[model samples]
Target: MTMKDPKSYDLLSYIVVFLGFYEGVLPFVAKSTDWEPFLSLPRHLSSPAWWIVSGLVIVASFFSLWGIDIAKKRRHPDA
Candidate 1:
């Protein structure tokens, strides 16, 4: 397989990580603390749709980080 640019993966991973944090972690914290969320989101945290979307974002972030690791390994097998 043609190796992808690790920098691209790095950038994508960072973005996904931020999204995961924003969607998954931030909402619960904001709701508990009575602080306004940074992004406008569904007010009902108990909604199944909200949980599903947040879970997907968190999973995607994990995969993105994993992709970066795999790309780095492909670039430097000896390291």
Candidate 2:
């Protein structure tokens, strides 16, 4: 967790949090009821909306990772 190392997970977080939520919730939701954990874009969703949404999601993800890195640095300054 050193400042130099900036210990932070990347792809692992994405798979575990995002995809895991999708997998766990989607199945149970459908089985219990007709609920959906999430949904894809509308068939007619505009390209600008798609790009803006995607860009924001990507930027937010990067910020999350960056914050984790900063936290690790604070937690274990000499790591």
Candidate 3:
């Protein structure tokens, strides 16, 4: 049996990408200085853990979009 690549990416994947972009930028633009490293996101952009989380989400979203394009190309090479 030949496995098929999905013709389209799911809605949740798009949502993640949006949320990820927000999560990644929120901390950087936050004006508040009193934020807990682990509890507060908008104020903890300086935290290494936060950076890692943000980077992961952003990269994941980007790759998700890229994968969607690849899948579409494979399914419809003429398009």
Identify the leading candidate in terms of TM-score.
1
Q: Encode model 1's per-residue lDDT on 6-49: one tens digit a residue.
A: 56656666777787788766766676787877473633556677
Task: Name every residue pair that clashes in candidate 1.
Answer: none
Error of 1 at 6 (Å): 4.8
Error in Å for residue 20 of model 1: 1.6
Q: Give TM-scores for every candidate, taking all chains together and pairing residue i with residue i.
A: 0.62, 0.44, 0.52
Candidate 3: residue pairs that collide: none
- Give lDDT per model, in order: 0.68, 0.48, 0.58
Better of 1 and 2 by TM-score: 1
Candidate 1's C-alpha runs over 4 A off are 1-8, 40-46, 76-79
For residues 1-79, what per-residue lDDT tens digits would candidate 3 score against the true structure?
Answer: 2224342344445665667667765555443454334533534545677668766766776887787667666776655
> Which number leads on lDDT?
1
**Model 3, global lDDT:** 0.58
Q: Write the per-residue lDDT of candidate 2 for residues 1-77, one digit (tens) a residue.
A: 22344234434355445643344334444434745434533212364564455445555656665776566668667
True-structure Cα RMSD, model 2:
9.1
* Candidate 3 or 2, higher lDDT: 3
* Model 3: lowest-lDDT 10 consecutive positions: 1-10
